[model samples]
Target: MKQYLQSGIVGFSLTVVALLMPVNGIAQSIGSDKNTLPDIGVVASEALTVDKEMLIGDAIMRQMRGQAPIIDDPILSEYIQDLGNRLVLQAENTKFPFEFFVINNSAMNAFAFYGGHVGVHSGIITSADSESELASVLAHEVTHVTQRHLARRALSQQRSSPLQIASMLGSILLAAANPEAGMAALQTSSAISQQMTIDYTRSNEQEADRIGIDILYNAGFDPRAAATFFGKMAEEYRLRSRPPERLLTHPLTEKRIADARSRMARYPEVRLPPSLTFHLAKARLLARYQFDPDYALEHYMAVNEQGNYLVKEAARYGLAIALLANDKAAQAQEINNELLKRDPNNLFYIDLATDILIALNQPQTAVEMLEKEIFNKPRNSVVVLNLANTYLTMKQYSKTIELLRDYLLVKPHDQLAYSLLSEAYKSEKSYKGMHQSKAELLALYGAYPNAIDELQHAYNYTGDDHLEKQRIRARIQQLRDAEEKLRNF
Candidate 1:
């Protein structure tokens, strides 16, 4: 129901590699043979036979984590979870467990993985901003899972074996068993698995859209919200000057919009709650993604009461980010100062202050500010990272290592944190610590494509005598080859 995103690095890379992975002759022909695509009955039959779709869902979660961290908020998650469950109550399959998660990316996208796995982006949450507007998107994604679109596609890979099934089940166990090993394997293997998902067809998307419209009506949400969202995306595309059809989409074309409009006219529609989040989310996105910093800033400045403080801060941050992108340092600094005055202790504000200082050549002030934040929140991992980066800017290599050591205590599994930590250790001439940290980082985040620049510094410090260096190097090579193969997709 939602469009796939990150077509360049994340999506394309795996697609490129998967295309090269040899498929059986029958498998190759089946994809081309639309006639051979399984019917709904057949798909349902297969789905029933493999009741452990839960395992597949778990694997998908693991693979997702390997690539990036999803934004997790307990209260918001609970809100979404309740909404999803409420909708599912009337559906045929009451036994299936459904999960909805928010991926923390700025890109405006959402998707359903095979099984009942569904994800919305933080951007979508910010974009929808309203219970009803958000519900419309959920209605669409839920339809994908409810209709078994992915399982039908699985049947397309006709002649899939038991081993494949075993691997699917084993995937989550592997991730749980050795998260680092599994994550590394995923970075090495994810492209191959997801390649099939993208080029795949979906007769089900149309079916889901049709069904979702009805669901929206029944749930007391405006059916028009669906078309409204599609129109919103189209408007975004035009305003941003994105090439026509740059994103392959369905249910958003002019005909689709017209069809929705006609359908809306036919239905005895109920009024929707005047949702407040759509414009705010849109404005925030503009601040983050648009090329014109000044315009984005003006847009937010004009609409002071449209959204919450978080939304306002986010908008301001995005505006400042846009200014920095355009190399407007002085203006950006002014904006940061304004924000800092408003939110004196906000972490993001502090981070932006650091950026402004860096741009202004006030490295010592940056160091002082970063140090204060780090000291005030010793257990906070994200803040410590900001401090470490500031240390790197100040060339206080030893201090960088010390702060990284503190951060690792709370966030051992964060690969970037560990990678940065290893760099700090190396800078301090602590070769043993560097060696240990690099191996762990590689094990967790994958060693491919310049695994860690800090690891090299660590090696320089230790005089390259570390025994684990070769293993890390070999893994890095595998990651690089895999990454290269994925580029074509």
Candidate 2:
């Protein structure tokens, strides 16, 4: 339970879902500036419930990652999914599925996207001094999600927008396209709805702290870990001879950590589960996929001094990932085998084994492994995408279309997913599929830069529009012209 945090709220995408308060005096907080449910209230909280929160969160996730997440690596994806699901089940509302992840960034922070999307910086994994310490962070974010703090914050601010959810969904992509611009926009938009950003009162902080401990204890995890992580951050502050700036949001200090310890003093420590080992194992893997392996190797060994099997697995995965990235396939393969021996049923190991086979010029074997992965992860878009890529490699265009079409059913709004689906359709002479897919693409991404370009693309490929298309097209040209004039000035 040791840690360090940066001044800025580490964001996964430019748009972070946050809850703001109507208090101008507290327009900002540490590790908070993201658009959270707390920042954007449910507008209709009289009937708000956990199920509804999950639905909204899922919708936000779909908008942020699209239906089929772009997971180039299956081993890494499945592992993180499993790890996230484990903690999600332990939170207050098990009905709400929480998806945890290591975003591909080097920022030293972690944050939760409203809905079940909890993200940690690739750097956080490498920085964790102990595996349980990481669990403490996940528990804190889970508290945010299960508590519906985002919606609460929104209601408090009295923020209202006609577009509501659509604007919220668009916020993520805005972050993706330009994080700074999106963050600025978020700040401005929030100010209109609330005061700006509300630094939670000490009472609010204490409540989150209490609930966070309850979550940790109930999840069968050590409550003390929460205190330890904060303690570590406090220590970091002393090391620098200055209080960590993130303290503005998190309010960290030995006093806060001691306070947290007192809150959990009555609770007995629970052994973290076997699943957490898998979580740390995968966190280590994903961190490598997201960061520099050399740095990862040094970090892994340091964090896993406990030599717990799972933490060691994390280091091993980190080491293999580095070797593979450096073109040392032979060495990577050896590590894969070692991992397989430890966890033969592990989805990640199975997938990694296949990746190694594919890299070693064993196409036929790779196909078999990928086909199995697809069958196992039937609902996962990235799994299907990988299988589709494998088909493309084998020159099976029809098979590619079949796989991509299935993927589009789950994630039609993703530009890359749609583009690939369009290519597959075009290759198979499925003109109807190709035309419909293109129009869908234009509608989503067309709203960016200039709407006219997207409208024109839709008009050319938008086969049959019965309503809304022409009206939308007209509005697009007008907006495009307006945008151009604004740019000229």
Candidate 3:
């Protein structure tokens, strides 16, 4: 989150080629005597089993890691995941592990794919006027995953090969991030007519909206949020020459918005207080992700002075972030100190304070604060990652390595952890460890060959450690097998 990001090209180009592979019968409908769509539960599994869906999902997710501008902030991730899981708890037909992540894009879009992964763009958070609006969007995406809409789409083309199915699925996923490119891929990848895909996708949206509202209400969000958010979207984009990515993918019609209103009307009206964390999250994005430091500082200062924000503390939090970014670490620390005094256990304040302390050259103080927080919430990602970062700043390489190694047990796919571990290994002159960590980082981006090369370097750097050499060789082989698997798919 602190660092700017770059999407890789190598794996992305490979996946784009895969998206161009031809599918012969993707447009064909199921042979039904009644000319009716079959029940998804009965046939979706037959076409694309859960295991195959997950495999394709993993491959695409790895590519996205390499190609998409994904945010690696632990605090933001924790907040979004917590919010997503609350709605997931009320969802039905959830068959796989759900992962929530944010992409560092200024587009109003959210997408869900196979393997229960949902991605939100930063613009969606900034655009949302309330937590319930954000939650409504998440609930819709969750429904898409749980209902297995993508797999059901595959079920229509039962005569197609697995490779064709994988290509088609990949096209839909690609469209979520890059609409024009994905549309081209979809056209070449499938024989399915554009209208047909749109029709099916529209149907899926209707179903998702119906179920998402229930999930949102059951999760304690106002049901009317669904309709209100839809109205906001329609109004905002009504006369725009180019609508956002979400509108492109979702295709919001007047009927859709009206349907949302009618459906939400069934539930009794409810009024809820503002969400502090949601505003804080939005402010964090504004202060750190979107604007320059100086502009952010001025914006937050105005918000704080005028008290125009939904939450006062969130405005102050933004001010602190802007202060930190502007190199006013002492002022940032003072604001953070006040915030922490008010809510000593808030992870948001703790993480910001950690950054401020490190900036002030007080690594020991940051370490002491983070360590205490970690002791109380042993698995809290915010505290753990902050502590690991503090250790790296303190040049406690061994401690950094140890903490990240354990943290990876829970978040093996965390690219930031791998990067930090690699830095620590390099600083400690552990060439083998450094190469091994770098290998994992590359592998996460689907650069299997590069990963294998790094493992070989690790093996060469290995001393007389027979077990370590063997492990490196095994890892190299695993990457080779994975590369082969992806190639075939």
Candidate 4:
């Protein structure tokens, strides 16, 4: 699987560069503006087509999902996607749909790939002092996609060898997922013109920063958060010999910080209300991924002792989660109970409380809690997924299937939901259902060939069921066609 993914990565990178190479007219125009920034409008109008860009983006995302430690938590994924979609609504010239993902890495970095896919590291979320700061980072990455900066650079540097461009892009995608491997790729790729690439990237950085501030302001976030976050990154970079992955790609400089501050000064000072979800998300990341459970428990306990009420509450939440991770379910339950009393409607509290009930072997209580939430928010993915999980835990296979089938109709690509459905199918001893669910799960991870094979196995297992066999055959054909299309790329 590793080798298959790596080969796909190389092929996709090469295809992206080849498709982005400038035509004769574009090449001539680039020759005249060799010293200036490429006309973004010209590149936007005439460079890589949207279809090809989506294909490239999809390929890169699949490879990353297969290779990286992506956080598959539905609650966190839904939170980030909601935030990103809000910003996307206010963004201009958004040619593609935006998708957000969280990487389970402690390094402070966020990156945008082709087709509006943005990924933020868990560390960046935990490091943020305010929601606006996190929004600023996301806004910057969104601008990169909106402006088509990567495609423009690929076209402008078409004069370079194809091998060089592919190597550079491969390194970038790798760096976005794994910093060490990316650094190694950079060091080994002798064909790349390091200075030239850096200069181009620096220019794109400035443009993204300028436009990102506008997006942040328009989206009702504090624009100054961009400058604030940049300043913080700069200070951290100075103190460390090896800066974070963000500095490695973004390359913060004094001029950039000054320019951001200058731009932010034009907007009126408007303070937005704090978001509870932001605080909860940060606390969750810190508790779940950043430190050992015992250390996180101690750390949050110390933090809770001296902070303001909001901070203290957030710290308490983190401490509770850490305690739960350490298997102290009773203590965690107490904390969650208090939190729910304060805000019963908050999904964060409800979800954690449900998990606590399950951990304590009180599935009936969890069922009742989630059932009420699902009644209020019938179509909420987080609530639905949690309820499905609760049902699965109780060995209520039919209820699990019935609940998830409707939800998956709307969200067919959700791997976690499909995984739960697969378990439910196995518990019910439905071989064909199990194989079909497994196929869908594999397809979500971009293993199309494997998915086709799964369906073929399902077809063989469906003895004397002509309709089911025919359905499996048809699904296999669709998977094959999809695989062939990607292969052609």
Candidate 5:
């Protein structure tokens, strides 16, 4: 089977890969005027249509699922998606739906792929001092997609072989995943190729920054955050021999920092209040994703005792999560209860409370609370997944299956749902359903052969049901065709 690169590499890095050929478009004057932003809209679709871009993006995303250390936390995933959508709403020429996710890496990097997929490292969230700083990075990535920079770069490389294009993109992704191996693979390419890629990316970088700042401002974030974030990254890594992956993909020049500050000056200064959700999300990362549970607990406890955090509630929230991680379930429940009492409707608190409740062996209480959330926010991934998990704990296999089947209809790409559904099916002794669900889970990871084998297993359990067998056969063929198409692409 042919494997593509991990998806969600930096927007500029992907565009840089496309720099395998010549870049089009005249370099617009960056300082043309403070009032009017340049219109770098979508280029010609004849070279690479939206459909093709989506297909390529999906292929890369599948490969990424197989290879990348994707964070599977629904709460964090939901938070990032909501944040990205806020910017997407203000963005122009948005031709596709947007999906945002987080990677479980400590290195500071963020990336966007052909489809509306954007991913940020957990490190970025932990490092960001404010939500706007995080939003600023996201806004830039969103602009890359809205402006169709990747498609434009591909358009310029229309004469190149598809495999060559894929290889370039894959090498960058490999570098992101394994720097030494990836750098070796990249060095095999010509030095001239690397130079051209950098030279062209500079212009696109300018455009993305200019447009992204506007998106950030329009979305009601601090526009100066763009400048502040850029300056911060540059200064932090200034004396280092090796910069962060973000600085590598998005080369931070002194001029870029100055330009961001100059452009941000055009917007009116507004002081926004502290975002509790952002802090909570960051705390979640620190407590659970970043450090050892014991260390995280001590860190949060110190923050709480010292009272030296951006948000006091967020500090306590972090402590609660750490307590849970350390298996102090009773203490965690007490903390969560207090937090919930204050913010009765906050999903972050509620999600954690649900976990705490479940851990306390109060499945019925957890079910009741989550059921209410489901009623209020039907089809909400966070609530639904939590509820499904609660059902599994309660050994309500049939209910778990029913709930997940409905949930999957809405979120078909959710690997977590498929995994849960597969377990529920197995627990309920529905062998065919178990195999079928497992097949989809494998497919998401781009394991086409294994997924096909799973379907065949499911087919064997069909017990001569002609219609079911026919459907299985058709599904198997579809997987085969999809795999074949990906090989060529």
Candidate 6:
């Protein structure tokens, strides 16, 4: 079973990398101008258009969802997306929309695919000592997208057979996730020379590092964090017989570390304080993804025992989450209440507190609290989703549907909202409504064929409701159009 799962993951990862490859003629001009940094925007401007990249990215993302264990936590997704966008606003030549996701893997690595999709492993978040360190890695990945390194590589090596290029790209991605598997893939493929691939990858890494520091500095993060993180990774690489997956692709050498430090020296030293959200995000990964509630509780208790007040508070917040996960609802509630006393307006504390209340079988209390929060922060998706969940728990199917439907109107791409709406429809015994909600959810992941079939089922269930049937047919046509557009790439 383990081998089967591993094979499935590798195959899926390859499909993702394969779909992002540049078309035949798009990359021919990539290396024509030696003076230019393979500026993908200039070279493939006509061939590898932004719209095509989006189509490719969206298609691969759907395949990934179907195969990988991508975390579906809305809060974590929102936090990472916000962080990526913050950096994007400061980045140069960003022509595509940036999307961030967390892979439920423990490998200390991150990667950027076509378009602006960046995937960070949960382990990296837990590994960082401060928010800036995490931001530094994200900045580096963002640079890859902004500079168009992947697209350039696709264009530069367009001479290689498609299968060969796919194999190389797949190996790089596998290496980012697991070094052993990646190395094995490389050994099996004779399509590309190891040394050549290494040299090109090194150049891309250097360029991304040089540009990433500037983006990090401009975005108000301490640039030194990049050097610091790289230095740490270098040491880890030295200690291990086989380096981590990140080292295989990034190749953090002594010179790279020194260069990052030199770049940091150019900027004024800034001791940016750690962000609370960063701590909460790390805590969420520990309590949820790691599935080690006891370990989280113990680790946080130790940190609280010796750390400063700010650190202590962060640790306490983590402990509360751990407590909740361990089914100690009352204890978690007590900790949340105390935290709320210190900062009553903290959404994180309030949301967790509301969750504790619901776990304690106090659904009405959860509803009252979340409703007030929603009124205060009307556009807050997290609070609104929480309220919708509370309504679902109370078996108020109509209220749940109404809230989710209204929210979905504004943010139709929200996966969690669609999922909740589907559940509400199921509870209400509305087969047509249930399938329709599911269709929207599937469509978000680029599962157009499945989505179309779902709408067809809904149309069938509509029977005599001509109006509803017409609406379903219209949505099916839209899905077909999207599928056709994807195929054009």
- TM-score of each model, in listed order: 0.51, 0.68, 0.89, 0.86, 0.89, 0.85
lDDT of the structure predicted as candidate 5: 0.77
State the displacement of the C-alpha of residue 171, model 2, in Å, after optimal TM-score superposition: 6.7
* TM-score, cand. 6: 0.85
Answer with 2 or 5, whichever has the higher lDDT.
Answer: 5
Off by over 4 Å in 3: 1-38, 164-200
- Ordered list by TM-score, greatest first: 5, 3, 4, 6, 2, 1
Residue 278: error of model 3 in Å? Answer: 0.8
lDDT of 6 at 400: 94
What C-alpha lDDT values do all the predictions have?
A: 0.53, 0.54, 0.77, 0.73, 0.77, 0.71
User: Which scores higher on lDDT, 3 or 4?
Assistant: 3
* Cα RMSDs, all models: 12.0, 9.1, 6.5, 6.8, 5.1, 6.5
lDDT tens digits, residue span 24-88, model 6: 11112221222444445667543455665666566656655654556766677778999988887
- Count of clashing residue pairs in every prediction: 4, 25, 0, 0, 0, 1
Expressed as tens digits, the lDDT of each residue in 331-410 for candidate 3 is 99899899999999988898899889888898899888888888788777788778888898889999999999998998
Off by over 4 Å in 2: 1-81, 88-101, 113-117, 129-131, 162-180, 183-196, 241-246, 273-290, 293-310, 373-377, 380-383, 407-489
lDDT string for model 4 (1-489, tens) is 000111222111111111121111101211322234344645644545676667767766765666567777877888999999877776655666788988777778887766678888887898899999999999888777776766776566656443344445556556544556655765786533552353326667776776677778778899899999999899888889987668766878899999998876677796987778899899988887678988988888777776743655677789889888899989999998999999888887877887888899998898998898898888787788888888888999999999998998988867777888888999999877888999998887678988888788778789998988888888888888877776654
Screening candidate 4 with a backbone cut-off below 3 angstroms (N, C-alpha, C), the clashing residue pairs are: none
